[model samples]
Target: MSHGVKKRKLDKNAQESLYFDSYSDVTIHEEMIADRVRTSTYRAAILRNAEAIRGRVVLDVGAGTGVLSVFCAQAGAGRVYAVEACSIAEQAVKIVKQNQMEDRIEVIRGTVETIDLPESVDVIVSEWMGYALLHESMLGSVLFARDKWLKPGGLILPCRAELYVAPVSDPVVEERLNFWCTVRDQYGVDMSCMSDFAKRCILSGDIAVTPVTVEDVLSHPARIAELDLRSVTAEQLRSVRGEFACECFGSSAVNALCVWFTVTFPCEDNKTLVLSTSPFKPETHWKQAVLYLDEPTDVMQDTKVAGEIHMYPSEDSARHICIHVDYTIGEHKKHSKTFSIPDGYSEAQQ
Candidate 1:
């Protein structure tokens, strides 16, 4: 139930540098590589599509540690251009050599948009998904590589993606909101007055990234947006807007909207491989994005919450994501709110 707010806006260059610098830390990469659901799904997708990769030149965009590039090489890719803009590329260079894949892999330490390859690639692979599918804005780089280097009819490792949303009853929010009352009883200090201030601080800005369980969900999930990586354009990604209407399973108070995503890989024999970050499925590094409501709304069985959700890059930092939600619960008046996914940079001085 913790939240963060950006105290000051950063210039584009500073923001870009901060984003890459964070990736240089080994901890972040360790989390990603250790996410079994995330790593194994990608491995299955690459191996399942081995025929498409064999004898083909491939490009791995934002290739942190070059794991995916190695997978492609093992799948018999003729050559792999592993493009990484962060210092992690140095580790990727060592990893490729240690795997005895130096001949098939070329680690390029530059942004995909600025890097030049000797020839077009028959396949483009990348694990560019961020929280809730678009938070980090890495899809833009993948699209750039796709347009600049992918051969005609070339395949995207995860060819399609979908974002989903549903109303949820989060007991943790209520517990946090009520903690101030406990302080008064414990220490004879009337800190209960801070409840309003605490709520204000939480709902003020920044979306919470937490693990949501199926029991917490109050309604069936609805698909809000689907992106076909092969054809979706950068302009289209600038703002992804979709409308959703979900019915509550029973009586409960809705505290927030739970969001997650899934990506698919098209394989041979008409089979499709899916990697989901849904709470109903095994958890991944991307647990879920929860947008807390200013006030909880109680609903009865079959109550409907209808709304439109809009996701876009923050104007201050293109790498950050902003979400706008306009929704009406049952027959109540419409409620509108916007939340931002924090850039995770250092807090600005007060």
Candidate 2:
């Protein structure tokens, strides 16, 4: 959906969506979402700030099932613009009516970019994070909405996010790689290295290797990037570049470096009321991003290493990421690189 003032469809598909047509061409995992509904920490701000919402104009993008919209209405919002993109928006309508507050909440069925908003909104609340906060890259659309619709002083929920990096050692990924090599070796003895086919799957299985949690990686994460929700746009977040130097804390076998970051929303106090990722959070859809050393690095305890990594978001529709990493451990130099989805690119990488 394109961002514009007039309420208009971007293409034929968008026009068809206006009818709330079923996706007969594609299969939806309805069974998977049957048991799920929704997050925490925002409850206090959402429930406690009754006055803030009481007479204010609010917008809820991707307001799946319309629960939050109803909450805003319950808080006395004068106009609650609830936007949803799924066919089940009818359920949200039913829920709104069951609560007996349809008068204050308006359910709009379309992408926020396509929906016509009457005027600027005082608040924009959205649950747009996807696995690690950038997976789907829907943040771009949100920014477009922010620039086009939010007035000065408008509030965006979960207002800050940070990216962190660290040196890590893990036995799991190494073991899995050896297992694949062994299996292929045995197959070659029988005049059928065709098992290379089986070995290939392990390489594509991003998680086939054991994952080193955030705790293992961040001895002390040197902050790389900190973004304020008050003003961040899709274009700006597309590429993250940084030069980071860290030390190998112990004699460790480094097959790859694991990188995971987090987003935190602060309360009135400086404390993080809700942290999205980083070392403090449980793994979300965003798995720890990896940069392999290709050939292992046997770092002596207490060696100084300087390195840098560049993360480029995929330009394709999939919104993947391509990562390049280079480093010098003590006197030894090593590197590894890989591209994101729709690709399995790997090189000697210097």
Per model, state how many residue pairs clash. Answer: 0, 5
lDDT of 2 at 257: 59
Model 1 Cα shift for residue 232 (angstroms): 0.9
Provide the lDDT at 345 for model 1. Answer: 29
Evaluate all candidate structures by whole-model CA lDDT and list the values in order: 0.90, 0.60
Which residue pairs of candidate 1 clash?
Answer: none
Best by lDDT: 1
lDDT of 1 by residue, 249-282 (tens): 9999998999899999999869899999999999
List the pairs of residues colliding in candidate 2. 131-286, 132-286, 261-278, 262-277, 262-278
lDDT of 2 by residue, 193-217 (tens): 4445543543432421124575456
Q: List candidate 2 segments past 4 Å from native.
A: 1-38, 48-51, 74-76, 180-211, 269-272, 283-287, 334-336, 342-350
For model 1 the TM-score comes to: 0.95
TM-score of 2: 0.74
